[model samples]
Target chain A: MLYALMIYAEPGLDERIPQEEREGVTAEYQALLDDPRVVQAARLHPAEAATCVRVVDGRTLVSDGPFADTKEILGGLALFEADDLDEALEMAARIPAARMGGAVEVRPVVVQP
Target chain B: MLASLVGYLRDFDAAEEATQEAFTIAAERWETSGIPANPGAWLVTTARNRAIDRIRRDRTLTRKIPLLPEPEATMDEFDDPVIDTVIDHLGDTGIKDERLELIFTCCHPALPLEGQVALTLRALGGLSTADIARAFLVSEETMKRRLTRAKAKIKATGIPFAVPQADRLEQRLDAVLAVVYLIYNEGYRGRVDLGAEAIRLGQLLAVLMPEEPESRGLLALMLLHHARRRARFDGEDLVLLGDQDRTLWDLPQLEAGRAALEEAIARGGRGAYVVQAAIADLQTRDEIDWPQVAALYRRLVELTGSPVVELNRAAAVAETGDPAAALEVVDSLDLDGYLYYHSTRGELLRRLGRDDEAAAAYRRALDLATTTPERRFLTGRLEKL
Candidate 1:
């Protein structure tokens, strides 16, 4: 099964980390992406830089920030190929953001044949 | 049969619908043709076929086509040789493993606790949705939605239909045992015969995981409680264990319970369930050992770190000819809102000849009591004071 591990974190959460621990945190995330099960991974730009776009009737509606105003914002995402949700969850739990005042949503990806 | 179907289909809702369809067909055809020699295998084969047909027709389930077993060359109805071949393919042991897998999947910790309980009862206990709803004091529609949402989450989250690996097995098994115990407690409170259903599930677990002594312990614990079910009450009034009629107890069931507890002990099991079973077994002895019971309660308090267990320990301490110390221990704990705490306090105070305080404590217990018999007992205590 394919799962999308969407990492949600408070804005500027990385900034709060001690300078000495920053490299270790980065290394942890790097280790996660290095896993063979990780099909694709990407760290997103801060939610503030995100542009939301929607086509309404005949006009296009654009927003300056994320689509939802929430305390936690989408920080990163990884697509994983795992046997089941439990395996995907194990990877999700390893995401540094998950233990650092953030959450990882383990969503099963829809398979298309 | 449903378990095997779920194993083959890998979709709970699809398997349930297919099983239902197969049973309906069997009910109509069995009357004229008489029952099949192997009714269970027949139902499983029919359900697998129905599920495969439904999945084939549904375009969105195209990805699941690969998971289905190879179809028979000819999909003829009631082909005895084909059924025999399929049954042979799924040996008897395979069916048993499938049921175990189904149980582990149903009671997975990833699911909500209520979902675990509901799904276990529905799938393993073979309770209808309506019956489960009634037992849980919910409307049929609410129960339906709960089951639907749970099943959907199981599919969407890709919860595997297999026993957890050794690393995760202990924690997962604890969740399963807790759900069964919760069902038994619900029935113990006089909801329905969910206690019987839980015992059946416990028996299945003990058989499936013979090496796991906790399974035997849980089976023992439930059987011990169930053996005393008839002696638990006299008409509508709650009969205290000491006052319960000995003849009303199921002696054979108690023996079975004791034997299960012995097996658990022989396996060197001292987990929460096993300890609890030992405590229960001690309680049923001809001569009660208050000091030993208190020691077990103390151990249980350490193991559970629960205030409720501490309260029980206090009760046992009182039985050891130290009501004053027991009362002091009860007062130290923050259980003012608990009915049993007040009742225990009242009893201790009455023993210490503090009638006025005991009456006040009884009033508090009376206010907190929810059951008729409990209220009556509290009132009687107050009257005596």
Candidate 2:
């Protein structure tokens, strides 16, 4: 079971996960910590760090940044190991970060073997 | 090939046409000759000969090989990879260097990052759009579009058939290395699956950039990480660190990885890929060199700040000394969907013998785990407690 928990919440919400919502979600996530299936997690910085590149006229040039600029830059992503699509979706819904302006993208970790 | 083409004729169009023709000749001849001993020389000589012939055939044509307006440097010795390919196309048509450059150029940052690696995999990695789609979990159509868009950009930009130089080199090289490294990574350490493509790409780069340390390092990194493939999992599920059967690790790849890391360092400061390969060496050492590895990873964090790097640093710290210290670092991260965060924390807690907290971590990790192997690995850990 693997999930790419991409936090699409609005940016600049940094250090401010609304106290009530924060408490609820933190608790929910804290509970997930108790589950046996979790494998890895990661939180990303805002999208502003991105610098886009495109080649034109026998030259490779760069632009200022990402395609879309918004408050909710991809704040972070977490990877998890899971059983099936249903289980992954169920777990994704419970993500506390998702409750506060974030959307978690669940994807299976593609194993080569 | 680029170098040879330049030597053949300074004109971009002429060199390219000749190189292509040379390759056509090799592809036809190599099947019968069974690939010459020095494939590169073979390709280079053939392409050069083709260019010369083309000029000779042109009646209305040229003066003396369309000289470079200045004394053209002999293509005798240079680290430029594309040059070697053109040269190799001269004699041996057994293998073409287009596939490698296709990866390098596609990974060139001039094209958008989103599709760079995917396109490289398709053109250079030689994976089908479907195989790439399966790897990224995206649909084949999307992958195809992505590749087409990338090729269009390359066409539109007319990106030179030359290796980057000066500041521009710094900018584009990352995408190039990323393309090779990721391809090799997936190729070498395929999860639950065999990694033939990765090995193929690694060996291919080895041939293309024989003298380049990073090229060697890329292959070394794959060999090193891949050496641990068996120990990384059981027949059924993924194997977590501290739980893996270390004895099953591939000693040869690990040895090669160590040598590659040293070589990269000896080659002086390179880009991130070489740096990362150095760290992988530390991870694979008999007595893991945690502190140095931590420092190396910290440098990586400065460049990438990737959460994966953070988690890895924590693991290094935990291995080096205090599990609690590692847990503190882990707690500070914003990681949520990542499984290693919880799993690493859980292992630390379990080592401390805090059964409840460890169980909590295992549970959290399981909930987040996406693959069957990961689930099984986490569940097995849970049961052990």
Candidate 3:
């Protein structure tokens, strides 16, 4: 089963991260992608740039910004194909995105019949 | 030795900088001279001599005379003739700092009780913010803020480093004892570098209030409790008091406890710590001193009027004579938020052969436990019952 792992990064971490440190983090992300079970992964821009897209009765509506504003923001996400939630969560935990004051939210993805 | 020595002679910030500078110099020079026989002693002597050189070269002391308090009698400044004196002064005993004055300063009751204990642990106990947070069972951010507020209050109030005066000292005695007791407890836990820090705190308080009953009581409490620490746990987990090996108890610590108890007895007025220590001493005795332990508990009840004291008294009272009497006392206590009281009361019930009631109490304790270890331990006891 594939799980969508959401990365929550503490505020202003991107600006604080040096170029060299950023490259190291990117390399870590690349290593995760190399694992065949990782079907999809992307480091999102700051939540402010996000446009929430939802489809109701085949009518798609786009919102101006992200879902919430808090002390932290949803910075990135990944999709992992694993046999169980625990296995998916293990992969999510090792993701560089989840380290350095970030938490990963693991949600199992459902496929349409 | 140099880092610690500099840290002592000068203030924290300056001493740290001087140590760094000395290390940098040593690193550069060592390629030629090779390593010294004793790196620490050589570093200390070099740092001191270097510090003196800088001081004489600066020639700024005369200018700052109005601002800087006159320094301590400079006991033989480091020169070829005075090297022996300097080394003696810098020896382990001289600079151990004891942290006595600092503990008293931090534990002043002008700060709230929580602040007094927390600040003393932070400043003198050498506890990190996260470590304090864990010990207090509070969030790290909350602990950081509390520490910051306490430090700001110190800076704003300009609280003198010297111990408080006569009337206030007597007024604040309880607070001091509480801080010392907490330090001792942390040391007894054996995690955290509390040995040097907390022992130093205890030794400091014991010296500061040589005649105070509770102070001696606090020392006796620590020595007695620490005596069992080696035997308290088996491998990673609590061995439970009934299961602990009596042979492993430290005879030296027990002797020290007896000496402290004598001092506390000689001094007369007592508090809860004295009572607790007396009970622990009784428990460790070859023959239980039931009557004395019960009397101390009764005195503690009079001092604090706390139901917790009544609960403890119940245990000693039962051990002395009637389990029935002890059960009644334990049954009367209303410790709604406390988990241990219920568990303890249950154990007392079991000893008196009230199996069903003991099982119920164990269940209640299991439900109330906050940690996985405590929950597991209580549940295991409940299952067996």
Candidate 4:
């Protein structure tokens, strides 16, 4: 089964961490990408750099900030092929953001094309 | 038979439908041909064949599907007394005891609690959607949709149709035990059929998971309470435990319940249900031990941290010749909306010769009491005052 692990990082995590420590975190995340179980991985730009877009009543509405103004932002995402939810969760817990005052939300990928 | 069918089919909804169809056929055929020698084997074979037919007719043929192996005996041998032997020769997939797996899947955490209860009742209780809906006082259509959605969720999440691995077993078992006890509670409240069904489910769970002590504990708890079914009431009025005839209790069930509780204790079952069962075990004694009961209640309070258990502990403390201590415990708790809290306070106050205060507490209890029998009992106490 394939699971998409959506990593949410604490707001201002980059600023809070020392620059050298941030590189170590990035290297750890890079090491995860080399894992055979991981099919896809991406780290998004910070929430402040995000532009929200919505279609309301057939009108294209654009907003300056991310749609959800929460303490944690969508920092990264990784798709992995695992035997079950337990395996997927194991992989999710390995995400750098999960141990750095953030969380990983795992969702099973729909099997259908 | 349904469990085995689910094992072979690997699709809960499809396997259930096939089993239902087989039962319908058997019901019609058995009326004319008389009952089969080995009804279980006959049903298993028929359900298996039906499921195979379903897969063959399925629109999504692109997906790889494992074919269910046929039973060793043919349908023509149904009347033969030797059919049981033939069933025994059937391959591994023919009759796997996957009930525990099915139960865990039904009570999967991905599903809502209501869905878990409904699914357990429908699947394990052999209840129709309408019957489950009626039990829950909901419309048939609503229950049908809920069951459908629950099944879909199980499939969508790929909730494996097997017992969880050891690391996850306890967490999964908790959900399963909760559903079983929930059904028992619903049945315990005047729903005889539902209660009986819950007990049956508990027994099945205990049998399926012999290593799981909590399962046995739950079964013991339900059976012990159920043993007192006959003496629970007198005509239209509720009979207080102290006044009820002990001889009227089911001796066989009480014995079985005691043995189960003993097994739970021997197995080091310290879970909430096991603790609660131990308390129920103490209740079965001819000479009630208030101190022992109070000690068990204290353990129960620690395990659950539930205000209700603390309230029960207060009542138990009152029995140990400590009305004032019991009153203090009750006063420290905040359960004003709960009728039993006030009722216990009233009894304790009355014992201490505080009649006026006792009468006021009884009035509060009476106002909060929901059932007619409880109201009658409270009113009777007030009349004496």
Return the TM-score for each candidate structure: 0.62, 0.52, 0.54, 0.65
- Judged by DockQ cut-offs, is candidate 1 incorrect, acceptable, medium or high? acceptable
Tell me, what's the RMSD of every candidate?
14.9, 24.0, 24.1, 15.6
Cα lDDT of model 4 by residue, A1-113, tens digit = 88899999887787888999999987988899999999988888888899988999999999898878989989889889987666777677788888888999988886553
Candidate 2 per-residue C-alpha lDDT over A71-105 given as tens digits, one digit per residue, 9 for 90 to 100: 56666666766544445555677776576666776
Where does model 4 exceed 4 Å of error? A1-3, A11-39, A45-67, A79-101, A108-113, B1-102, B112-162, B367-370
Which residue pairs of candidate 4 clash? none
For residues B1-385, could you state the per-residue lDDT of candidate 2 as single tens digits? Answer: 7775786588788888877887888899999978999988888888888877887878335443444253322222221344335445634656654555445566765568868887666555556677777667678777777766665555434444544444344455556766766666555434323254565566765565555666666666667777788887678676665577878987876787777667766876464667677877767666777889888888888878788898888888887878888888888998876777888888889878898999999999999876687788899899999
| Position B75, candidate 1: lDDT | 21
lDDT of 4 at B287: 87
Model 1 segments beyond 4 Å from truth?
A6-38, A43-76, A90-105, A110-113, B1-103, B112-152, B165-167
Query: Which rank order by TM-score, best down to worst?
Result: 4, 1, 3, 2
Best-first order by DockQ:
1, 4, 2, 3
Question: Residue B30 of model 4: what lDDT?
Answer: 98
Task: Please write out the lDDT profile of model 4 over residues B322-346, one tens digit for every residue.
Answer: 9999999999998998888899999
Q: TM-score, B chain, candidate 1?
A: 0.66
Clashes of each: 0, 81, 0, 0
Q: In candidate 3, what are the lDDT values of residues B336-382, reduced to their tens digit? A: 65777888878888887889999988888877776565776787777
In model 2 chain B, where is the ten-residue run with the lowest total lDDT? Answer: B71-80
On lDDT, the candidate that comes out on top is 1
**Candidate 2 docking: what grade?**
incorrect
Taken over the whole model, the C-alpha lDDT of each candidate is: 0.83, 0.68, 0.71, 0.81
